[model samples]
Structures are given as structure tokens and as C-alpha cells.
Target: MLRGLTTVSHFSDDVPAAVAWYAELLGIEPYFQREVQGKLAYVEFRLGDYQHELGILDRRFAPPGAGTPGGTMTYWAVDDVEATYQRLLDLGGTAQQSPTEHGPGFVTASVIDPFGNQLGVMFNQHYLDVFTGRPA
Candidate 1:
């Protein structure tokens, strides 16, 4: 049974550029990196209140025909979905979906990163409640 998210891996043709882009967006460098045969192959950043892992893996390791954008959409919790979405657009990400209110305490947005990965942001009251150790 799936318990919780451990790592979210994104494929990138240019690992270094992906790492730099993510570092800038996260405002911190990756805490860990790995090289395969002297070539950078992966980088991992620990972010958010839970310190979840965000991983950038060399596209060469991706599954067959997985280069195109379209797959699992992982939404990271944010304080301001609109502001975060705008920041992503300013950072060279293409908007996939503008900020939209799903219901009373939930707003969501998505963007396609420069490396062809979809990144989602959300402001969810339930997530905040659980994060704060309050009843969801």
C-alpha cells in the first residue's frame, strides 16, 4: 500500500541545466548528487516542510518513449498558488494550467518546466491541517 511520497523523479536531457534551474526555483542547491561513470546522472533536493525529495535524473535513464510531457502530476503544497504559478512562469516555465479554485479551500496550478516535466502547485487546507498535526 502506498503510504506517502518519498521522491518525485523528473527526467531531463540536460542534467546540469535541470539541476541549475531547480536550484534557482527552490532557492537552494541540491543536497545530494550522483555521477554515473564520471558523468552527472542525478541530483536530489530536500524541500518543503516534510523535506520531501525532488530528484532530477538523466533522461537517458528514462523509460522508452517517455520524453514527451504527460504523466503523473504531482502537486506540491504552497502558501500561495497564484504567486507560485506566476514565479514559475517568470522562471521560464510554460503555463499548463492557470490557478484555479477547486473548492472552498483548494486552489491548483500547473506548469511545464523547461525540461518538459509538469510541475504542479496547490494551496490545500487539508494538506496544511495534516502538516500542522491537526485533523484533516
Candidate 2:
């Protein structure tokens, strides 16, 4: 049995810049930020829709090899894929894949954050309707 994702943590060389970038893109200010072991380090933001807390951690304090971005990327469902992609680009995010239709009514795009983590934005009205048993 699975519950739900609680948090997604990312490592960054510059914590302040990473936090600011994410805050601007996600439109959510950090709910918590604190120093750990006498060093100003971790920052976490609670995103809209209660998805999960996004964390920006100082890579110097991260465990061995933990600073590297994993093979798997994280995706956030958005109502407007194009608008969000543009916003990300404007906020210094690098576009890895331009918005594309994945299937009937499903669109997706990928962008790399300042710290090299891949973030994806997806829109799928058809899939949503099917999942919720409603007309699209």
C-alpha cells in the first residue's frame, strides 16, 4: 500500500539562488528555512495543491554522491503547459524539451533547473476526464 509523496529534495551549489528561483517559478514562498549544525543550509517550500514539500539543500552538506541529479525526473501537473514553460524559461530554467503532445490531449515539456535537476510540466485534460469519469 502506498500513501503519498511527502517531499522532493534537491541539492544545489547555491541554496539562496535555488530557493529564489523555485519560489518564483512555483509561486510559493518557503514555509520553513533553517540552519543545520551551525551552517545556513536547508530550505523547504510547501507547494500549492499539497503535492509535496520541495527542498533546496546545500550540496556540500549532502551525503556522498547525493548531490548528483538522479536518472528519474520529477513532473508537476499544470493547467497551462505553455505558459508555465515560458515562465520557467523566463526565470532562468533551461528548456530541455519544448512542449509536445504526448497523446490525445496530453502535452509535456522538460526543463533543467539551475542545479541540473530535470523538472517536467504536463497537461492532460483527456486523461483527467477519464480518471475522474467526467466529460472533457
Q: Which residue runs does candidate 1 get wrong by more than 4 Å?
A: 134-136
Model 1 clash pairs? none
* TM-score of model 1 vs. true structure: 0.94
In model 2, which runs have C-alpha deviations exceeding 4 angstroms?
Answer: 67-70, 126-136
Question: In candidate 1, residue 21 scores what lDDT?
Answer: 96
C-alpha TM-score for every candidate: 0.94, 0.81
What C-alpha lDDT, on a 0 to 100 scale, does residue 31 get in candidate 2?
A: 90
Model 2: per-residue Cα lDDT over 7-102, one tens digit each: 778888888889888888777789989887776599998874544788888888777877455577667778889999999888888889999997
Query: Global lDDT of each model?
Result: 0.93, 0.80
Give candidate 1's total backbone clashes.
0
lDDT of 2: 0.80
